[model samples]
Target: MTEPAPLNGFGPLISFILSISALRDWAKLLIIGSFFETCRRLLATVWSSTIDSFFLTASFEDHDDSYKWMMIWLSKQPSWKNVRNVNISTGERYSGNVPDSEGESDTSGMPKVCYLPALSGSYTLWYKYRWMRITRVSEPIPGWGPNHRDSLNISIFTRNHDILNTILQDAKKAYQDAQGSSITVYISDSANCWRELATRRKRPLDSIILDPGIRELVVEDAQDFLASKKWYAERGIPFRRGYLLYGAPGSGKTSLIHSIAGELELDVYIISLSRSGLDDTGLSELISDLPERCIALMEDIDAALHNSLSREDTPTPPNQTAEFIPSSPRTPTHTTSKVSLSGLLNALDGIGAQEGRILFATTNKYSSLDPALCRPGRMDLHVEFKLASRYQADELFKRFYLPSSPKTPADDDQEPKSNPAQSHLNGSICDGGSTDLIDLGVPDDVADSPPSSPSACSEKSERAALTYTGTRHRGHAPKLSSDQLSALAAQFASAIPEREVSMAALQGYLMSQKSRPSEAAREVSAWLQKELATKKAQNETKS
Candidate 1:
């Protein structure tokens, strides 16, 4: 009676399944599969542990300097030539050109291409007789939409950690060598992180047309400060220096800073105080995060804080009279910057401020700044950059028109002779000082002739082609010896009034007459007269 009751539910089904031979065989197969899977997992765990013990793994994030070093090193590896899967990058971060496989010159003005390991791909290469594996992975960053973070993982098949250090040293050396000719410029992002903006060619200190002894003073001071770190520490003073370059706009303040950075082999970190979303706390954080032995630039420092307070908020001078005050109701200039004067002061010399960093602040209005900001400990040295002087104008003109010196016989003897025709074609002298063009059947009349002008031209076109037209020309200047350049430079400087025009204006004037040094010197008085008259009229209008 109990069996009859159970058959109504599952009793009949269980009995039917147990009676089938195929069902029994299926159950046995399920048990066997489970056992094999367990064994496979156990073996995998053991294999992973063994590999980890013998392998050294290191990871480099894309944002870090080491990542760039590794990428450059990897690009030069012989293994990449044979690799089929790779990423082609034209970014400056990779540094140097990838050798063309077909040995053709790239004259297209395109950025150099580099081969990088593809994302999520594994690559193998040998380093110092040790097998190495590189894997580049990209992962989505949380809270950043559509933005991913890249990382490089390197696994070396060795038990010694010294091999990794050696590889890193080699990579770092290669990166330094590649970057030797340029200086890296960094700027802060909205997220308050320093990002590489560009790699500027190292501008020689001589190329900057500063007044005599001004360049020497700033450069020597910076060099001495950098070398006197131990002296500062011994005296219990912070190993930091600040320079205040206050004067006229376009007076080579920023250029001087850039040249100093290049001369000192230090990277430049530009601190934009008026940047959107940047506030007091952000500025302090940025300053604190600056690297040691780096240049921290804050340009237009006065403008950033000039309009921070309204006229009513600003304290009236003790010497001021009621009549001296402006009758018009003055409103503060609107700025996206939330940085205050106190915030900037603290950022410059706070306890958290980075040590050994050289800070450079430039301002067009020196007298407008608070005295506390220009104090000894904060500003240290205050260098005034007035408008361009006659010396600067003279030096600039010579630099613009002077040709590179010819090689001496001693220097020429060191170089091995290549192709005679090619050397002559490149303006080098062949036997009897004849050019390769003559041998190529070119007539002397055609070779020596100047560039031809258009047969038909309007009066406007002829005037536009004049040196004083204020239009830029790309033609090469006539090759002048040092003495000839000095004569032209002196004549040009005589026409330029001292401390009236900025170096930038003179450079612009020179750029317009790039191919006509003689014309530029002769027409300087006319250009200066027009420039000064225009400036006076503008000033009168403003008044």
Candidate 2:
């Protein structure tokens, strides 16, 4: 009964047998191919899972750029606080980038910083529909001992491999942009702790008025030197800049230094030589721990430590020195001052010195400092801040007085006044003569009356009244020309003969008579004469 299928004809039976062999061969090949295909799919799934959970990490070392950027990035995210304990260390930010209810800008008093999450905490951030997991970890490498300096870690997890890099780059860019608004200054309070002393509002670097050559040179050097960090690394040199600003008091040394700091947006860490507890060790520590992109200012250093460097030569400008000698500083007699010359020098160019520091040492006594301290590399550029030149004085005068104009603002009633104070904004002045702006310091109110005879319009008549025009506290800007101020500045500069009058004195004098440009111009000569006389008398007394 089981062998009944063999009843078919022999030809049909042969065909069936061939079909079975062909089907058997095809089935065997399919099974083998399916096995290989399954293996390939399994491998692809494993690789993709490994990559998704690969655990890419970025360890943050204290004071490192990455660590700084991470902290800054954490401070910016609104959702970060919800994930972490962020109630402490909160502060207000004043950048005007925030928006308002009416779609207008309202940037005042925005929250800047809040305490971020501690270690071993995880936060998930979503951006552009892509989710990223951030886990704070401090796993140690097998050989790295416990309490490693770089123990802080920020583990970034994402399915998209490129997301982590993109996040880090965006953070770095944000940190840079945020720092552009102000400059910070750090002062060393303890051996390891540098307390933030001040945060200076940014000033336009162009506002610093110096000799044109000096201004150009300082600006160019600052830009070139800061940008040349890579150049310095290749050459194996510390990326630093040093400038010595020395001259008479009130010559704008300190102001120039501040301007440079503002221009570079670098913090200024002042090492007060006169500070009671400061010694060589303390100073060295301060120098070594200086954060990157900072200016270390040791102002009035010549007077701070009484180093008995040679003072035989008269103080001269850097360019004026026909005979420049790089003298090795002679040791001074041991003084009560805590700092020593050797200690100062070692901290300056020491092997352990911090990189990316700009140093400025200002002194009134240019010849008083030790030569070795002022040598090249340490004091790469020695600039003497002298009294304001006639050109500078003219500029100073215009700067002080030109912004004072606008008695008749466009909204302040179109009606003209009969007096010089309220009426002189337009080219018209209330003078008795021609109804034109008194270009030569003469106001319209007191100008000599139009000639009834030729004798009435005399030069002396108009010039005499010019003396009183600049005395009033008029809100209007001066009608004086640059040429006119230059004339007065030339007179002021010429009286001293030695260019000994400092800008500080000139500024004070001009500020006192700020409302009186004509009076300032005319009286500046007398003031300079008196200043010179007093200085001479003081020198005689000291001698």
Candidate 3:
């Protein structure tokens, strides 16, 4: 008693289950079905086989060339050439493969396809005469926790492995050539190769607040490094540069590095030592293969060292007295990292190390660093970033406002106020500012550097400094004359006690004032007085 046949058979279910792309490919398959049928019979009669196939699987979770190649190739397939419905998204990418223009080198304005209805399920990827079936899948990886990220599994099957490998390599090369760089970041997940580091575009150098001396030093060194690559080979130098940037967290240490990368037209390779599975071998391999003229940055060197090795195992200098900082609340009871100080030393300039590399190590705990690690050959330059200074405070005010000095007021009524206490009136502190009043802490290179696309904050300032744009503030209000601006800058600088405030704190204060320079100045004055009072009170209480 085989039950009565169902009204609708498996035929209807098959049609319903097949995706549109799959259906289209199936039609093509049927057209060539006879050809394949004839070959199958011939092969079967001769070799007892119908066809050969190579199966390849790719995952979106992978951050390597294999995954990158597959995903890029999939995007170029003709099957989804004319998808009816697509989701597009914009992103900022910094590619290391191409020379960057002056500004926004790390940015991309292109839109990416996020969702393709036609390629949502099964599809066909055809290159040349070779073709393969592609299926999109989302599922958890075996042995991973349930909360782990889902990976998109892309399966490709073809009759020839040669075509698969060749097409993939060619496709990657073409894609990179067409797009220059796609804002990809590479890192080490293990001892094998560098994986992409996921991060947003960084601030330009001009956007950062730094000592002019350091900026010049960095750029000149970069120039020397690039020009001397061949020279180093001609001579017998290692052709490597190492910089140590140590300071408080918000002192623009990292921002300066990003700016330098853009200015030098080089890519940045960041090393995150905290990443699990990284050891001495992996670290050494990473350093030895750093891109030429590229910056190999290891941020928070002290923290990584702490996790990698025990405190007693690390060393300190005998002559330098250590400054005592309160223990961080996040002290870990135990760590599995095997990174050691010696291992780091070996990674930097060991025999296997690559030349034409700009290495930067940043940390707030300068005192904790072993003198051996930062000795002459390892870190050639050690630059300390201090808190806000009088010069910096003046620059901050000028940055928050326009750089041009206000036009000489035709009448006294239009003159900018000179009183620090009354600067906030008329909605802007820079209403009657002047550029000639002070050098404003600007650098020679910054003034001399080509003013292409300026950094967000540096645009107006550069124009004023370089070409004297005399660009107005947000409301198009005229700037103060040089005398007025100089007076205002002096007042602002005087109000800020040198080395007493952090740039981060000063920035926060300025932001709170909105774009009102006068308001920021007044409030900052009151705030400083209160801070001084609070410090005195705390000191008395402690005593």
Candidate 4:
């Protein structure tokens, strides 16, 4: 009975609405719209499937090396010259093989400029007659502030992956060609991820004035280690080597390490042990993440682990100075490193350590290091670097003042006219001069004459016109013959007093007298006295 009463109310309402012409028209329009919308969606799905079957897409993350290769390759593309939209970047990320759009020939001392595809913009390019679409997008990282992850999406019209492989190979080759003359240096970021720091010009191994056999020993050992990977795999040994360069501050330890890296053609990854937020886990991760072949450098290793070193538990000898033995164990500050000695030791030669990495550790206080850290499996070779010796000083002086360019045959043929004063100072057999003591007093500033003031100018202008009496910028060294240079180098070495001053100190003193090799040799004795006196004062104050 209830169903029957409702049937009539529904039927009358439906009939009344159907009687309206506008309602019928509205119903027809609604059905037509629904049909068209359904058809549009179906077509879109079909088109997407067709694209998926025919296109090969690849994505390169900014953190990966492929991203760098692709960016470098894209910058060298001929299409960029005609493209109206681009991103002009001053950062080193896109620095390889990019032409300067500003038309400046001499870009030295200026920030490198690179043109990249604008962010969020799609670019169509042709590679080997195949069509490719490139899209660069930035997505926000979960917790990193103000930092976003970048990815390069490339879709080519061919389904064959061989084309993609070809593109990658060409891109890598371009990148390598651009980086042929330099070594890339990398450092860890706050997230403990490696980031490219800079590309340093390869430092010639000869430029590092280390003791004889030191440079060759380190370089040859590293080279051998790199070539011995298969040998290590057969013996079930980890194919890794470590070098410990411990010596006085300002010695050539760091310089030698850099030169060895360049000579080996390996990238340098600097692990700042004192970096904030670094713990044992982070250190282990960093070491494990190192590429198969790389130079991992840790400078001033003792300073970072002063509190956790093995010597902390041992009693200091009474004769040892505070420099060698800390008065008190340094507690790790909030901003300092939290890496323990055990963590560092494990990270160096742990099971997860990279197989072919070369670890270089430098320290001024070798006695303070843990014996476990310097063990054979960890630090395979230990090299002691002392202060500048006579040989190092002589070599350093010659290298510093020597002309960079090669000399002509005629210039080489001409013999140098020996100077009696220099010969006497060098103690050469060609000079029979008296062995009287040379004056060691500070030389007078005879070359510096104050500019005369203009009588018509104001006092401010006159003061401004006065010569700047402060430290003057150094100029090129005076050209001298080989014999003269040899004699001057001998004289400079003689005044160095044998291992009393560091190579860096000697280099600094020579830098002050860059254009005056004779003055550098003549005034070295006076400079040494002041330097020794200043050291004594510092020691007394420390004591």
Candidate 5:
């Protein structure tokens, strides 16, 4: 009775339990909903992966072409036959766009767009069917979509490898067209080395907090430089740029390089050739093996040379005859030995050093450098950071003081102009503007009057009175223009007497201007007089 044959094929029994039309409708809806949901999930996965991958497709002249015929012939010879990879995808079969997972058919009428996977090996084949499609074909247009057949095998394996000759050939043609002129070419030899020195600190970047205005300038230069490098890179030229920073000690030259690296998003490799034991061979090895796309620094080259020179003290005998001369050159005895100048020069830009390399050298004494080192062809650029001007003063002040300033306007009528003011602060202020006085607590009358010349302002008591805060503890102060104070800071920041002045002394001078109107003018005036005296003496010595 329980079985009654279990009502085999019980469609009639189920129909009696449930209405037939209703059941049929529910089943159809379930099947349709499942199909739509599955498609959506598949589409989403494909889009996610596409965003993470970047493909580079390039075309070049073939073996039969005049420019690449020799290269192709070389690749075919038994001795060099390994250069050609049958696995590479190439040929006329790919006259149309390469197929993608997505259904997009239009290629803007491009004849070929072959697909290249992220091939990691040194020798990859160029062929239509040999390559594996790592991506599903069920998504929207791929990142590098509408692939065509002009896909040529390119060498992404080694920088020195000749596989990219075609790309280079194309790049040269494109570059010439873009520039509308001929291009100069220079290739680094493969024999020189850049010796990187060890430093106590891993990164010499902490000083950026000391000078943010200069930091910003460094960033702007970095952006321009990187953009230029990229332009060259896309044209298949080796990417490189050179910079020279020369100035007084403590002028933030080294600090500036570090900030530039941080701003440009690059790694910095410091090569101190002065480390006592490096020689031509050692330097050459370092330069040849440098990691690509990193900074190479040769800090204080002048100092390095002086130290090197001091170590080579093989003086001539007072009355030695020609015959008495040693057959071999005598090695000088010194605390720390170094390579010769020729070695250093070769290391600067020898053919053996790595390509796409950036070199930065700093010196306190530019005049002392050999003509070859700082010349246009060697360094490409030489920038000098001079003594602070009035413009620089405003920069330093804005950098040091702006962070502590109030963000909102004191009065509702003055809507916040923080962004505009910040932008303006990067450059010079023509005259003491209305806002400058209001911030400084100057008399509104003085704020409204036309600003006087810096020298005249230095001479005027009222002008000094405008900046003084009256909290002076070091007693009588001097009157100084913003320009004069800036000059003093630049000149005396490294001076012997100014170096002796306690941080407290400097802070006292800066704080005194915050209160007591009577002596504000006198304090700045006296400070300016001493600073000008030092500056004049410096100019005379240089002259």
Candidate 6:
């Protein structure tokens, strides 16, 4: 049937044949080109996903100078939390002609991988698997097990202990927990947990529980203070609270604060004005970004005062030059190296919204504090954490000696539950041996009832004592009166030398004493003796 079609021009038939061959070759080439392009795309996607998943990130936009400044400044901070064995992949390389820039690969920034047990009683760190990869988990890991050995062995084998097995396990767990049903777990080389746990080395707060007498007095004040915080919260304002604790050097101010944080189930954001080199701007930014629910503390406000603002009020006749200028040198006058108090003030409770910010400022010199600082708008409640009165001692004992546990309501009293005197005490002391109520001397009669009855001890003077005990009461902490707490705080404050002692030091000391109560007690007694001796000598000199 096709034989009839051979009757065409020779030139036309030849052109048609050539056209057919050209079309066939073009089709083959297109198919080959498409296959290569698909493979390249797939490889790129795989590489990017792997990098993104395996590494933690700290993004800094290349176009912004602030990003560069942040990186440089962060690098200079010796105490900054390290990023750990992380491999950073900056986007800049992916910009312009390059891809995968190595600028962010500062291994030094990564945190050192080390063993950190879960604070919760759980020994297992929980992790989940996704898409054949361990994704996210938050459960505690075995404190000591195969994983621990693997971590140590890895350190030995790779000589790069940076990628610790325990750390990987931890990171893997966290990743899996966060990923949910995702087939991928994005493990971070470094855990932000280090930054949080660093303060674990701090002094324990329980050691400064008040003596029975002081607890009675201070417990109520603490309650009122808490009530005030709740009052603000009830109005729908952010449930932020600020405390200004000022008193003698050995007062239990700092200890009281730590106890409050622990009892309230809150995180503590401690800002040592003397240490963290925070300019007004830096302090403000840090404050602004603080977690919505936590405590922000600034210890020793008097020492951190701005010299300029202080001088402004000292009998200076409006910009008058000093009568006696410095004779040391015709030195070029420069702005005095002073922190801007106004800047700090604005950063705190400025005209702007500071609704949810909880600030606690402590100092031994209340007189040195500016009146404006303690004015109604700023530190509205000025409570002095003072020496332990008789009432404070008992409360302090209860807080330190008691073992916190979930309690059943007590039915010991037939008096109306509404009556402050009839409030039944719940919760039991820890199995840890109990110290004699007054073997060391000091009144034991602090309070007879539970701490929930704020009204029973609700005098303004008793507010601090009652409120302080309220937090400890539910947590298996000892139940000391305000008087006892005050004395305990005083005892603790005096333990450190006259020189500046950090909250960390205090916390560490307390933790040490927890398992060794006798040692802690002896240390406390010795410190108190020294403080009394010093006070007596000062009085004689004044006379």
Q: Considering every candidate listed, which one attains the maximal TM-score?
A: 4
* Stretches of candidate 1 exceeding 4 Å from the true structure: 1-47, 100-106, 144-146, 309-332, 404-458, 462-469, 472-474
230-262, model 1: which lDDT tens digit per residue?
Answer: 999999998999999977767899899989989
For 1-543, candidate 6 gives per-residue lDDT tens digits of 556676569898777876898787887899998999999999999997776565432223322222323323322223323333222333221111111134332233333222221221222111222111111113334543222210101111222334344444453454333222222101111111102322222234445554334433444544555557667667755454566766545557766666655544345666644333446665565566565555677766655543533434434234222211111122123443234777776767754434555567876555546776676656756765444443344344335545445453442232233333222322232111121111212123444434344343333214333333211111123555566555555555444444223233334445545534344555765544654586557656645
For lDDT, candidate 2 versus 6, the one ahead is 2
**lDDT of each prediction vs. the true structure?**
0.78, 0.64, 0.61, 0.78, 0.46, 0.43
Worst 10 residues of 6 by lDDT: 185-194
Q: Which runs of model 5 end up more than 4 angstroms from their true locations?
A: 1-238, 307-335, 403-543
Of the pair 4 and 5, which is ahead by lDDT?
Answer: 4
The clash number for model 1 is: 0
lDDT of 3 by residue, 103-206 (tens): 33332334432333223466555556555555544444445223333234544455555765686687577545534422345566454455556543544566
Model 1 residue 3 CA deviation in Å:
44
Alpha-carbon lDDT of model 2 = 0.64
Runs of candidate 6 with Cα error greater than 4 angstroms are 1-194, 197-238, 306-338, 351-357, 390-533, 536-543
Residue-by-residue lDDT tens digits, candidate 4, 15-65: 999999999999999999999999999999999999888999999998788
Worst 10 residues of 4 by lDDT: 430-439
lDDT of 5: 0.46
Estimate candidate 4's alpha-carbon lDDT, on a 0 to 1 scale: 0.78
lDDT computed for candidate 3: 0.61
Tens digits of per-residue lDDT for model 2, 1-543: 576565558888767876897787887899999999999999999987787475555666643456656666765666664664433444323121222456643344445334544566667766545555655555453432233333346555544557667768877876667666677666655333455555567776666667888977887898899899999999998788899877767777778777878777777888876566668887788889887778889877766765433334556556543122211132233445476788888889988788888888887666667788888878999887776677677667767765444454442554334543324322223332222224355555544334343344345345545544333332454566767766755654444433566778778877657656666666666777777788778666645
